[model samples]
Each structure stands twice: as C-alpha cells, then as structure tokens.
Target: MSDPHLTPNWSTSALLTIDVQRDFLSEAPYGVPGTTEVLPALARLTAAFRTARRPIVRLYRRDGQDADLVRRTLLAGGAAIVAPGSAGSAVAADLLPPGAPPLDPDLLLAGRPQPLGEHEVALFKPRWGAFYRTELDELLRGWGVDTVVVAGCNFPNCPRATLVEASERDYRVVLAEDAVSGLHDIGRAEVTGIGVGLRSVQDITASLTFQEVS
Candidate 1:
C-alpha cells in the first residue's frame, strides 16, 4: 500500500469493465465520448485477463424501472437505453470472450450475473457503482479476488464510483487509465487520492503476463 507501483498484484486481481455496451459506444446515438477510442486498448486488457485465467467481470447499464433518475426519464421519453434483449444493450464485441453468451438484460436487472465464459460474467448495473445492489463484491470474493482492475466508459460516473466502493471494501484497485473513457485530471487525481493505483493498459497487461509466466 505504500508504493503505487508495488500495489497491484495480478495474481489476485479481477478485471472489471463497465458500461462498454453498444449503446454507450462513441458512435451510438447516446454514446459516451471517448469510449470508441479506448476500445483497442480495453480489448487488450480483456484478452490479457482471459489468457491469465483471471476473473473478468463486464458491467453494462440497463435503463429500466430501477434505473437512475436521468436514465429513467430518458426511458420514459421513448429513448431506448440498453434495452434488454436489444442489440444495443450488448457489450462491445471487441471486449467479449469468444462465443460469449448474449447479455441477459432481464437476469441482470433482476440482480443475477450472466455467465460469459470460464471465470467471466456480464452483469447489469442499475446505477453508477457496480457493487450497489449487485453481486459484484460477492462474486469477486468468491473468486478469491483481492485486487480489482477497472476499465471502460464514463469514468467520472460508473468507473469512479466502483473504484471508491472497491476501496471501501478493502480491495486493492487499479484504474487502467488509458482504457477508460470520460477521464479527466481531477478524476484521476481523486481516485488515486483514495489509494487507487492508476496504470496504463500496457502496464496492467504486462503485470498479467508476468504473473502468468512466473
């Protein structure tokens, strides 16, 4: 905990990508800015975690009855927001496991995680934080994950909130700085102020490879 460089231990880390769904992509109608630009790097991180046989958790935003006020209002106004079973609700294809199961919006809304691949899952988050009313913390603990590596869309929202929650739960957290969208200087500084380690996509993947080999 003394050194940011020494903080991340990949052996016990879980990779969590938030709000990387199709609808949140930069090209989509309701896209989050910078999401598309980060996809390539984010894909690398996912592939690294998959190859390392670590837990990979993918989070999507589904604007349903339980959605946050802004999203609920948008939904009520006929704005289709990551509608369950809709193509737009699915995670971005580049980051998904090969032959990953489709995003089960209903199950996620009901607070159940959908299996994606071995040691991987896709869950829906009703709010900015992944752990809020979700099984994310339980799942990580069950997987023996003591460290969390987070990346994806809307850093100031979901990713940031999840980082703070992970810290509160006493899990070492790493933010893949270049792999997340909507990031700003203050947001980066704020997370680190709470003991979050900020690393690059290359840095995180390098750690994974090192752990995998020796």
Candidate 2:
C-alpha cells in the first residue's frame, strides 16, 4: 500500500479519463458542478499520456437498453441524460484527439472498446463504477497495465468508485487531483485511506519519460 505516485512507472500505467462526456459537464441536465473547470488539466494529462505512448481509456457513461432501475425510472420520466446516440452522450470534442473515430453507442453499450488512437480507446460504463460490468480490467490486462491513473467528471461518483474498484483489483491507483471534479479534502482522505495516491497533472507529467515518435 505504498504511494505509487512517489515512484511511478509510466510504461505500466494507463490514464483513465472517466465520464468526460458532454452530459456530465456544466449546462447539461445531469451536469456535475466544476466538471467543466477541469477540462484544461485533463487536456494536459491526455496530451502527456499520448506523448508517452501510455494507454488511455476514455470511459464514457451511457444509458443502456437494460439500464438499472434508477436510470430506467429517469428515462421513463423523460430525462435524456446520456441517452445512447444522443449528442449529450458524446465525449467532449476538446477531450478527443483530432480525427479520433466517432463513438459507436452500440459497441460501447455492448461492452466493446472503440479505438481512438494508437494507444487510446473509449468504452462505456453502465453505472457509477467503470468496472461494474465492463471489460475494463481485461482490456488493461491485455495492454499489460498494472497501474491506473484516473481523472475526469466527478470524484464523488464514477471517479471514486473506479478508484476503489482498481485498488480492490490490486492495481496501483493514482488520482489526478486537479483533473477531476467534486473532490474535496475529505474525499481525498477517503481515497488515500484506501491506498490510492494522489498527484496533480504536473506531477504526473513530470514523472513520465516520453520517447520521440519514430
């Protein structure tokens, strides 16, 4: 349970951008306050991961055909938050690499990973935790990633849930503090108590050794 941020290995680490979709940011029906504020930091982190050739998993939240009771109720009530195939369900354009392939709701809802770039892919989560019913763990294992660096929408929900799930699975977890929303001192303490290390985007980027594109 040592601090993974103190001595990091970029090669074995993957950056998980959780729920950075338009539906979860300000002005959206289900927006999390301060979600939009973290975009610049997340953008920096994304670029750093791309340059380092580390894997990036952009986890999006989607309303599935078999959504849970809460979501089903909301949908029945006419809330279109993150409804599949809606514009609001899309990942923010600023967060995606230029020319990144459009997200396929069918693929995502079916638990398939959509390729974004050489070392990046997008997958959809059915609920608060990315690992709940998704192939995230398998995908990371296939990429040989032993550490997870998480950033995005809201710390109280998806980010926190994903971090705990990663820790439970024995993956070294690092929280990109400034690149996520809804994080306060108490929430951070809760995360660190569970052996999750926290670092700012700058600290993470500085730890990486980027190679020249060949």
Candidate 3:
C-alpha cells in the first residue's frame, strides 16, 4: 500500500472527525483524557478541509435504547453520556465552522447524514467503528473520496476501530497524529505496520489546496 503521508491527494480525501462531542471531554463519569488537548489541532484541520472544499464527516456517538449491551448497561444505571438531544451529545461548538448547523440527533441516530456545510455533514455511529452498519462508505463513495483522513477523541477506541475498518475496506488512510487523543508511540507503530500513514495536522494542512468560495 502506498503511504498517503508522502503524497496525499487532498482532492480525493475526506476528513473524518470521530466522537469529539462535549461528553467525551468532560471531567470524570464520561471523560476521556487527552481529548481536550487535541481540540486546537482538530479545529485547524477542520478549517483547512472546509477551505479546500473537501468532504468532512463529523461522526458523533449517540446512545439510545438500541445501544450495544455495554452502553445500554451504563445507561440503565442512569448514565447521561451522549444521550440523543442532550447538550453532551452535541459536537463541540468551537470545532464547528461559523454558521454550521447544530447536529440533528434525530437524523444522525437514524444512521442518516445531516448536512452541516457545503462539504461537511454529520453522521452518528452506534458502534466504535463508523463504517459498521452505517451509510459512511456509500456517502464517501458518492462524494468521490478514495482516501480518509481520521482525527478525533480516544485513539484506542473509536478512532482506532474506524482506521482499521477503513483499511479493511481498501481506502488509503491517514491518521492525523496530533489531532487525536489516547495515541502513543506503540499504538502509532501498530497502525503504521498495517499501512496506515501517520501525519501531523500541520503537514496535512500545508498539503491541502484551498478553493475560493464565490
């Protein structure tokens, strides 16, 4: 597999921002350490993708009655994390571009895409992997995206699962190293061994080509 880090075709790539919702950044109860630390890098990359007119898919988690057994067990005990329509379920306000619509929990939880901008949309993933039982692959295909750049909270969880799934499906994958949490050198080595290209947000932003909006 060719390494996307060396020659990223920005025009053929889409950015996938996974599970960066407010709940995941809170202290205790639901917080994932290191998530908040990556916000600035994620924001910058998001802006660059928006400027370049490339597809941006924001994948948020929404826990509902149909959630997996573990999540449902937590919810049964009255955990309020990422429940649909709750403030915690919403994407971080600063990560959104100006005038981007708030995530539509109804549409997202139904596994449908909610338009957030001309080239950005939000989708909900019931599981750790966004491609599992979701329309993500089809949506990316429709937009002509052959490669996926992934960044978001918790590397060992959603982000890692999504990266592996993307690779299994044969999409050239790039892991935005500085823009994802829970990442360490060992994990980095593991993914790289499987042909996942790793790059910093600065490198990605510099390689992107911006298209002026009329």
Candidate 4:
C-alpha cells in the first residue's frame, strides 16, 4: 500500500481518540508530560468529526484484575483514573462534545453501545488496540468505515500500538500529530515507515472538507 499522505480524501475516515480520559491528562494520576499540550487540537478534531457525522471512537482502559498490563502499571504508579466505576475513569470533560450524553458506566462495562451525542459513541478497550478482543471491528464494519484518523494520548504505547494494529486490519490510517502526545520525531518516522499518514490537526482542519459518510 502507498503512504496515506498521498491520498487527499479522508472524509470517509473515522476520528479515533485513544485513551483521552482523565488519566492521561496533566491533572490525572497517569498524566504524561506532553499530554496537556494536545487538548485544544483534540477538541477541534472531535468537533470536526462530530460535525461530519463520522465515527468517533474513544479508547479507554478499565482498572481491574483483568485489565491490560499497562493499566495495572499505571495504577501502581498512582494513576487511579482507569478504575472501572470511578469518576476519574470517565472521559475528560473537555473531550466530550457539546450536548453529548454522559458516559454510562453500566452500559460501557456491559459491552453495550452507548451513544455519544449524535455522531459519536463510547467504547472501552480491553487492550492497546481497539480491535483486541473487542467489537470495534464489527462496529466499524457496520458503519462501513474504511479509514481511521487517530488522535489522543501517549504515543509510545497505546496510540502507536493501535495504529500498527489498524494497518494490519487493512484500514487506511492517519495519525493526527497535534492531537497526540509522547511522540518523538523518530517515533513519528517509524509510523511513516509503515505507510500510515502523518498529518497535523491544523493541516487537516485547514484543508479538509468533512462531508458526511454514508
């Protein structure tokens, strides 16, 4: 496959915000140093996705014995934000679109679909990729989503891993540079090596006209 950067039409792509919950932000237990810098861009991307009526998948790790090792490690370091029923486990208030419904813990934990405003929905990921042992693939298939625009939270772990997995699943991928954190230039190059599109939130927002995908 060619690099997705050469493709101009990303309107068919869903915007995926990986682990943008309170835990990864500056004020949360699992805060990454650069995480706070991306909020404004993330907000812009979220609004764009919502307006386009494109799919928006928010990935979160729940705290439990069955939780992924990363969540357990973060919790051990005093990042208690991923606890299944805790308020801190909830998505960051800023990331929620205007008039979006509050997260339903019961529905989320039960693996039921919970709507996020009109164009978005919330799903809890059991592992790094949204596809790992989850219904994200099914959901995307149902929506006929072929491309994925990924943003949010640290890069070394979740976002990076998720991108690799998405590529393996044959989805055209774009990584929103400004809406993610913990990514160094070298790491960015690694993603580009795999043919994932590397773009800034500003770049996409400035030039891309988001039309509703059928």
lDDT tens string, model 2, 1-214? 3444434556789999998989889777778899898999999999998888889999988764667676787777777888788888888767787789778988887789999988899988888888888999999999898889999998998899999899899888899999999999999999988888889999888876443332
The estimated TM-scores of all candidates read 0.96, 0.92, 0.92, 0.88
Query: Can you tell me which runs of candidate 1 are displaced by over 4 Å?
Result: 1-6
Candidate 2 has an lDDT of: 0.86
Error of 1 at 135 (Å): 0.7
Q: Give the worst 10-residue stretch by lDDT in candidate 4.
A: 205-214
Q: What tens-digit string does per-residue lDDT give for candidate 1 at 1-214?
A: 5685438778999999999989999999989989999999999999999999999999888777778886777788899878888999878877877788777766877889899899899877778998988899999989888999999998989999999899989889999999999999999888878899989989888889999999
- Expressed as tens digits, the lDDT of each residue in 1-214 for candidate 3 is 3644434557789999999999998464688998888999999999899888889999988776878777788888888888788888888768887788777777877778998878888988888998998899999999888889999999998999999999898888899999999999999999998778899998888878432332
What are the clashing pairs of model 4? none
Query: Mind sharing the TM-score for model 4?
Result: 0.88
Give a tens-digit lDDT track for model 4, residues 156-211.
Answer: 88899899998898888889988899889998899988878888887766544534
- The runs of at least 3 residues in candidate 4 whose Cα sits more than 4 Å from the true structure, single-residue gaps closed, are 1-8, 70-79, 210-214
Clash counts per candidate, in order, are 0, 0, 0, 0
Candidate with top lDDT is 1
**Which of 1 and 3 is ahead in TM-score?**
1
Cα lDDT computed for each candidate against the true fold: 0.89, 0.86, 0.86, 0.78
Return whichever of 1 and 4 wins on lDDT: 1
